[model samples]
Target: MVVYAPAVLFFLAFCVGVLRDRRRFSNAVFLGLAAVFALAAWLVELIREDEQLGRSVVVGLLVLATLGIVVLAGFLVSNGVTMIRKEGRSPANLLSLLGGVALVGLLALLVAAWVLHTHTLLVVAGTAVALAGYVGFLFLCFISYAFLYGRLHIRRRADYVVVLGSGLVGGSSVPPLLASRLERARAVHARLSVRGRQPVLLTSGGQGPDEDLPEAHAMADYLVERGFPAELVEREDRSASTEENLRFSKSIMEKANPDYRCVIVTNNYHVFRAAMTSRQVGVRGHVVGSATASYFWPSAMIREFVAIFLAYRRTNLGICLALLLGGALIWWMR
Candidate 1:
C-alpha cells in the first residue's frame, strides 16, 4: 500500500493538470508519468503475490511486450533508413539513426542485466531511467508539433486556395480524410467570394501505385460537381507528396499570376506538420485545418507529433542522448 502511494499522488496531479490546461504538453507528461508509476506499482504487487508466477508469467509477458516495442521501433527506423536512401540526408533520417542507436543500446543493456550477475537495484534503476528517457522523447514530439501549429499565420483574404493531397481511396474517389480537406478549402473560397473577392481553387496530387488517376483531378471534379466554377479550378496533377503539392502548386500559381497569396488546407491533425513542410519547401502560404472525426484525432495527432519531432532530429536527439547517459551514470553510481 505504501509503495502505491506515489502512483496515486501522481495520478491525482495528472488529472488536475489535464483539467487545467488541456492544450499544454505538460498534461501529456503528467499523465504519462502517472501511468508509468501505476504500472510499476501493479507489477510489484503481482510479483509479491506469487513469486513463481512473477518469475515465469510476469517475466515472460514483460519480455514479449519489450520485444513488440522493439519491433515497432525497428519498423520506424527502417522506414527512416529507406527515406534516407531514396532522398539523401535529411532531418527525418537523422532521427531514425538516433532512435535506432538508442533502441539497440537499450536492448543490449537489458540482455546484459538478464544474463550477467549485476546489482539488482542498479539494473532496476537503470530501466526506470531508460523509461523516463522514452517519455521525454514523446514529450519532445508533442512540443514540436504544437510549435509548428502555433506558428502558422494565415491572411484575412487570399487570391487563391490550395487543397493539399493526402491520398485517394480507390484511385479516383476522395477518401473521407481528403474530402475533409477539400470541403474546408471550399468553405474558405465561399467566404472569400461572399466578400466580393474571387480566388482560384487549386487541387494538388499525383498518381501513385494504386491510384487510377491523380488526386488533384478527383478533387477538381468534386468541386465542379458541387457548383464550383470549372474555369476557376486548376488541377496540379504532378505532385506525389506534400512537398511536391506545395511546390508544384506554387509554380502553377506563379505562372497564372506572379503575386498570389494562398492558404493550404488539410485536416486539423495535420495542420502543424503541413505548415512546417510548407515553410521548408519555400511555399509562401499559411495553413488551415478541416474538421476530423472525433475517434480519429488522438492517433492521427500522435502521428503528426512524431513527424514534426523527426523534422528537428538533431536537437531532440541530443537532448534524449544526454538524459539517457546521465540517468545511466546516476544509476550505476548509486
Candidate 2:
C-alpha cells in the first residue's frame, strides 16, 4: 500500500498537467511512469500475500506478453507483404516486415550473447538491449497518451477546423491519406454546427515541386465535391511543413479572432506529434485523428517517435553521453 503512494502522486500530477495543457508530451510521459509504478506496486502486494501464487501469476503474465509480441510481429510481417503487393515496394510499405525481422534478430542476439560467453560481445549486446528497452518505454508512453488524447471530446465550440495536408497523388489528385484528414475536418465541422456554430474549415499545405497545385487547393476541392459548403472553407496554401502549417494557420485565425479556438485534424498516427507542433507554435486547439492504413501505422509511428526524440536531442544526447561514460567506467572497473 505504501509503495502505491508514488504511483498515485505521479498519476495526480499527470492529471493536473493534462487538464492544464493536453498538448504537452511531458504529461503523457508522467502518465506512463505512473502506470509502470502502479503495476510494480500491485506485483509487490501479490508477492506479499502469497509468494508462490505471485510467482505463478508473474510467470503467466510474462509468457502471455511474450507470446503476444511474437503474434503481433508475425501479423505485421504478413500485413507488410500485403502492403507491398497493393501499394508497391517503397521502403515505407516494407516497414512492418523489417520490424518483424528485427524482432527475430534481437532474440537471436540474446541467444548468441548467452551461448558465446564473450565479454566484448556481451557488453555490446547489453548496451543495445538497454537502449532498446528505454526507447520502447518512451514509445509506450507516447502511444498510450496518444490513444487517450485522440478520444477526447470537444468541450467548447471552435472557430476553425484545421486539416493538415499530406502529398497529393500523381500531382493533382487527393489521396486516401489526405482525404481522411478532410473527412475528419468535416466531422468536426458538423459537430461545431450542431453546437450552433459555423467554424471555418481551413486546409493547410503548400505545393511541392512535383505537385500540380497547392495541397490546400486540392483538399478544398475534395471537400466541395463531397458537398461541404464553399463559403465556410478556407485555405492556407503556403505551409510547407507541420510547423509552418500551424504557424500560418494561427496567423489566419488570429487575424479574424485573436482568441479563436480550433481543432487540428491529422491521421491517428500523427495526432500526438501534431499536438506537440501546435503547442510549439502557440496554437489554440486540441487535435483529433482520422483513421490510417493499418500496415502503414507501425512505420509511421516509428518515424514520429524519431522526430520527437530528435526534437529534444540536446537533453537526450546528454543523457546518452552520461550513460556511455557510466558504462565505460563500469567496464574499466571489471
Candidate 3:
C-alpha cells in the first residue's frame, strides 16, 4: 500500500490540474509519471513474490523494447519515403527518413563496438546513447500525453470558433491541410448552433511575402464557398505564426466579446501544442483537431516537437548533459 502511495498522489494531482483546466502540459506529465510509478510499484510487488520471475520479466521487456525500436525505425523510413512522393521533396519532409537512418546507424555502431570489444569506443557510444535516450524519453512523454490530452471534449458552449492557418496553397487558395481545419470548424459551428449558441468563426493568418492575399481572407472565402455563413465569419489577417495567430485572434475575440469562450481548430498533429499555446496567450479556448494525411503526420509532429524542445532548449540541454555526464562517469568507474 505504501509503495502505491506515490502513484496515487501523482494521479490525484493530475486530476486536480485537469479539473482546474485540462489545457496544461504539466497535467499530462503528471499523468505519465503516475503511470510510470504505478508500473514500478507493480514490478516491485512481483519481484517480492518471485525473484526469478521478476528478472525474466525485466529481460523480456528489454528484448521487446529493442524489437519495438527496430519496427519503429522501419515505419519511419517507409513513411518518410511516402512523404517525399506525396508531400514533396522539401527539407522538412526528410526528418523522419533521416531520424530512422540515424537510429539504424546508432544500433550498427553499438554492434560494432560490442563485437570489437573496444572499451573506449563503448564508453563514448554509451554516453552518446544516454543523451539520445534522454531526448527520446521527452519525445515519448510529449506524444503520449498529447494523445491523451486530445480526448478532451468541449462540453461548454463556445462564443468563438478560431481556425488557425497554415500557409496558403499558392498565393490565393486554402491548402488541403487548412481546408480540413475549416471543415472541422464548420462542424463545430453546427454543433454550437444546435445548442442555441452562435459562435463567430474567426479565421486568423497574415499575408506572406509569396502569397498574393492574406491566408485568413482565403480561409474565410473557402468556408463561405462551402456554405458556412459569411455573416458569422470574421477575418484576422495579421498573424504570421502560431503564436501570432492565437494572440491576434485573442485580441479580436476579446474586443468583440470581453467574456468570450472559444474553441481553436487545427490539423490533428498540431492540436495539443495549439491548445498549450492558446493557454499561454491567455485564450479561454480548448482546441479540437481535424483529420490529417497519415504520410504527413509523422514529419509534421516531429517538427512540432522540435519547436517545443527548442522553446525549452536550456532545460532540455541541461537534462541531456546531465544524463550524458552521468553515463560517462559510470563508464569510467567500470
Give the TM-score of each candidate.
0.60, 0.92, 0.95
Q: For model 2, where is the 10-residue window of minimal lDDT?
A: 124-133
- Could you tell me which residue pairs clash in candidate 1? 171-212
Candidate 2's residue-wise lDDT over 226-324, tens digit each? Answer: 899999999999999999999999999999999899999999999999999999999999899999987678778877887898898888777777766
Clashes of each: 1, 0, 0
What lDDT score goes with residue 57 in model 3? 91
For candidate 3, the per-residue lDDT at 247 reads 100
Please provide, for model 1 over 1-334, each residue's C-alpha lDDT reduced to its tens digit, 9 standing for 90 to 100. Answer: 8878887887787668545533334554566666677777877887899877766876787789788658956865675566566546766345555556566766677677767756764555475556656655475546554544445455767888999988887678888888889888988888778878889899999988899998899999988998888998989999988889998988998888787888889888777667667777767677889888754554455556676567667876777787667766766686
- Candidate 1, lDDT over the whole model: 0.74
Candidate 2 error regions (>4 Å): 89-91
Error of model 3, residue 260, in angstroms: 0.4
Q: Lowest summed-lDDT stretch of 10 residues in model 3?
A: 148-157
TM-score of candidate 2 versus the correct structure, residues matched by position: 0.92
